[model samples]
Target: MNLSIDVTNNEGVSNVVLTGEVDAFTAPKLKDTLLPLTKEKGQVVEVDFQDVNYMDSTGLGVFISALKSTKEHASTMRLVHMQDRVYRLFKITGLTEIINIESTVQGGM
Candidate 1:
């Protein structure tokens, strides 16, 4: 799986834009990239999936693990711009309620 990550730091928030497939082979990579960003004090991490084309359970696991790690470090993590299929996956897995998923970057409101 091919994965690309672009991280933007803004006002204590880390916007991570993810593109490409996130599967077992690539989930760890995503985790590694997100873990450190979420460890910073007062850091709010947002994983943007607007460009993602595919994902699997491992991808969901990556998000869950990131959320757990972020909470441990007193940081926040959220999902943004998920495609319809990705959103359905979250809904089917009941992760939509467990994680912070926004339709847009503006708090999904």
Candidate 2:
């Protein structure tokens, strides 16, 4: 399963929607897609993972790196509409506490 990222600008925020498998072989693509967005100062970025079917540690690493980059630029990064499996992974790994994860679009931070 190939990973794909679609980026769009909404108001002043950047919405990055990710789909397909994000594993060792495909996590780099996700990272590359998000790197530039995080470089800009005060840019709000939200990564929607509602359509993502699978992910691994590499994928989680990519998300963490992106979050760090956003912080360095004084921008905010969030994860929205995560699937149950993905949400569980975040919980077990303590990532849910470190990064904001929304259960639904209406509940985003």
* TM-score of every model versus the real structure: 0.88, 0.90
Model 2 — which ten-residue stretch has the worst lDDT?
Answer: 100-109
Candidate 1 has its poorest 10 consecutive residues by lDDT at: 100-109
Q: What would the TM-score be for candidate 1 when compared with the true structure?
A: 0.88
Give each model's whole-structure lDDT: 0.86, 0.86
Model 1 lDDT, residue 40, Cα: 82
Give the runs in model 2 whose Cα sits over 4 Å from its true position.
104-109
Backbone clashes in model 1, listed as residue pairs: none
lDDT of 1 by residue, 29-92 (tens): 8988988988887799988999987899989988888888888899999898987777888889
Top candidate when judged by TM-score against the true structure: 2
RMSD of 2: 3.5
Q: What is the alpha-carbon lDDT for the whole of candidate 2?
A: 0.86
After TM-score superposition, what is the CA distance of residue 27 in candidate 2 from its true location, in Å? 0.6
Please write out the lDDT profile of model 2 over residues 5-81, one tens digit for every residue: 89999776999998888899998888888888988888889988889878889899998898889888888888898
